[model samples]
Target: MVDDLALARHLADLADAITASRFRSRDLAVDRKPDRTPVTDADLAVEDAVRAALAEHRPGDEIAGEERGGQVGAGRTWVLDPIDGTKNFLRGVPAWATLLALVEDGSPVVGMISAPALGRRWEAASGRGAQAGPPGSPEPISVSGVGELADAYVSTTHLGTWVEHHSRESYLRLVDACWENRAFGDFWQHCLVAEGAIDLAAEPIVNPWDVAAVQVIVQEAGGTFTDLSGERTFQGGSALSSNTRLHDGALALLRR
Candidate 1:
């Protein structure tokens, strides 16, 4: 069997090279998708680089990316979100990252997230524990032990978007229930939860590319990742990642 986790991390390295180079370029080009979300040249370039690498390294494997879509195959499908926080990258906020996940038999068995701007990267393989640290030296990571919602630290992307998605009431309830809340947004929040720095990270809306890699990382880090309805699939259009202790209570409030 191929070392899928190593391959995933290699892809992340390739993506970081492209993204870090153009991160704040004066001439970086930007466009808007039909959904009105922003996409930048860096995003397209990063995805193209990752796809090309996969084509050469694992040509038979299927691939799916945010910029260009492809079907998930039965054997292996590489999922890519070249830039998970495009808005942050566009604004030079240093909050963006490249996300790559290798899905085997419809489940992500290897996952890697590289945030060059933040000088951080995280990776996990099914059976191997999750890890995070500076790009070079990584240490094992796990979820926090916060057992109650009242003591948990919660995070989300945007309150306005959450409200617009018809989840405002429940989201507000979650925020109110938590001891602290921040709009830490995107992959960073979920990664934080995986690192035990936070207790929960959720979004009222998300795509498969947005959460596939993150789901594996969190799960491998001793947390639970699910939709508001408690289903553990990335296609649910929303995400709720938490240290296992707080997942049910948080999901219950979100469902209300």
Candidate 2:
């Protein structure tokens, strides 16, 4: 089981090499899918590299990547979002990351998030606590002690997403209830919740790849992850990460 975590780390390292090199390249290639989201050359390259490494290291494991589009079914599936913040990557925002999660029986047991540009990598296994920083030296992390929404800090990807997918009014109720808030979009906000930098990270729209690894890290770090409907599954179509003490309250506000 631990070996699977090691393989995920190795895969993150492989992705780092490709993403770091191409992050700000003058000649980086960008394309658009039917959804109008940007896909950079680095995104495709990192997924391809990680897929190859997994083929050699864990031949029997299945892979589902943002670029390649495979399914996570009733077995061990390696989920990959080669670049969790592709728009950030393309625009050189420094908040993008390579997200990998090992899902078994529909739940992620091992999660690894590598944001090389920020020089931090956060990871967690099902029974192990979460950790962050470089692989050379890691430190265990957990959620904040804030128990009340009025004293908490919160975040989300974008206000526009709430309007488009769920309800911006509902998301605003969450923010207005908090002490402070930021847009801190993508994987970083959830990681912040895990490491206690913030108290809540909510998103009205997300794919499983967007939050699968996030679910594990936050949960292992003494937090909670669920959709607006309050279901604890990553495939719930939306997500909210919070210090466990504040999860229910946060959910109540978001559903307002």
Candidate 3:
């Protein structure tokens, strides 16, 4: 068997190189997907680079990417989101990241998120512990110990999506109960939860590519990652990641 985690990290490195080069390039091209979300040349380039590397290294593995779709085979499947925060990246914000994951039989076994603009990267395998920082001096990371919602710091990508998806009331109630809340948005919010910088991070709707990498990272970092309904799967269409201590409470509030 291959060292899946190592391969994931290597893929992240490959993606980071492409994304960093085009971060704010004035000539960068932009397009819109059918869902109305933005897609940039950087996104397409990053995915293409990773896909090419994977083909050379693990040709048998299936591949699925946000910009360019591929099959999810019965065996190992690699998922890629070239840029998780394209809006932020286009706006010159430093919160975007390239997310990658290896899924085996429907569950993620290895994951990685690389944010070169922010100078950070995080990765995890099913059994190995989660880690963050530069490749040279990585550090093990874990979730916060916040046990109560009233004492917790929370984050979400956007409230408008929640409202549009019929989750606004539940989301607001949870935020009202928290000590503080921010629109940290995208992959950064969940990475923060894994790093113990925040207690919880939720999203009303998300594609598998958006949460697959972060799911394993959060779980390996001693946190609980679930959909708003409390099921622990990235395909749930939404996410609610928190320190294990606060997960149930947050889930209950969001489901009520």
Candidate 4:
């Protein structure tokens, strides 16, 4: 399991190399919500590199990536997001990341998130507790002890879907409940939860690749992860991560 975590982190490094080198290299020609070609190329390239690394080390393990889809192999599988925040990447923003996870049976046992542009990386195994830091200096980290909802700082990447699927009024209720709210979307918001910098992060829409690595990091950091309804599964497609203390309170406001 520890080996899987290490491999995932190493693969994240490989992904960072491919992505960081190409982040701002694209021409800023916003023809229509940013050209997809550059990010698509980078995505495929990173997925390919990860697949190749998996093939070499965990030869029998299956692979699933956002860009390349899936290829079954051994009992243990890896789910990857070559780039989690593609829009941000294409926009010359640093909110993107390389998300990697080892799913044993059906759950992620080892997860890693690398955002080279932000100079941050977080990695964890099922039992090993989470760790986060700059590119080099790793350290143990955990969620904050903010127990009151009114005093909690909260964030999310987007509000369109939340306002669309749920009610804008409900979304506003959540914002009103927190002391602070930020739209610091993508892996960074979740990382902030893991580092205890924020009390909660709620996203209206996401995917396994979007939240898998983050889920592991949050849980291992003494926090909790769940759908807006508080169900613990990436399949929910939306998440509400918190420092555990304020999770249910946030859930209550959202559910109301």
The candidate that wins on TM-score is 2
TM-score of each: 0.97, 0.98, 0.97, 0.91
lDDT of 2 by residue, 94-210 (tens): 999999999998999999999999999999999999999986577999999998899999988777889998887888788889899998989999999999999999988899899
lDDT of candidates 1 onward, in order: 0.90, 0.92, 0.91, 0.83
Which 10-residue window in model 4 sums to the lowest lDDT? 28-37
Clash numbers, per candidate? 0, 0, 0, 2
For model 1, state the Cα shift of residue 54 in Å: 0.6
Tens digit per residue, CA lDDT, model 4, 130-153: 998886678999999999988989
Q: What is the per-residue lDDT of model 1 for residues 33-99, given as tens digits with 9 covering 90 to 100?
A: 9989999998898889889989988988999898999866689999999999999999999998999
Q: Which pairs clash in the backbone of model 2?
A: none
> 1-256, model 3: which lDDT tens digit per residue?
4588878878888888888889988998999988899999999999999999999999989999998997555789999999999999998898899999998888888989999999999999999999999864679999999899999999986778888874778988899999999989999999999999999999999999999998999999999998888899988899989999999888888985
| Candidate 1 clash figure, as a count | 0
Candidate 1: stretches off by over 4 Å: none
Q: Considering lDDT, where higher is better, how would the candidates rank from best to worst?
A: 2, 3, 1, 4
Cα RMSD to native, each candidate?
A: 1.1, 1.1, 1.2, 2.9
In model 4, residue pairs whose N, Cα or C atoms come closer than 3 Å (at least 3 residues apart or on different chains), thus clashing, are 60-74, 157-185
**Which scores higher on lDDT, 3 or 4?**
3
Clashing pairs in 1: none
Question: How many angstroms is residue 243 displaced in model 1 relative to the true structure, after the best TM-score fit?
Answer: 0.5
On a 0 to 1 TM-score scale, where does candidate 4 land against the true structure? 0.91
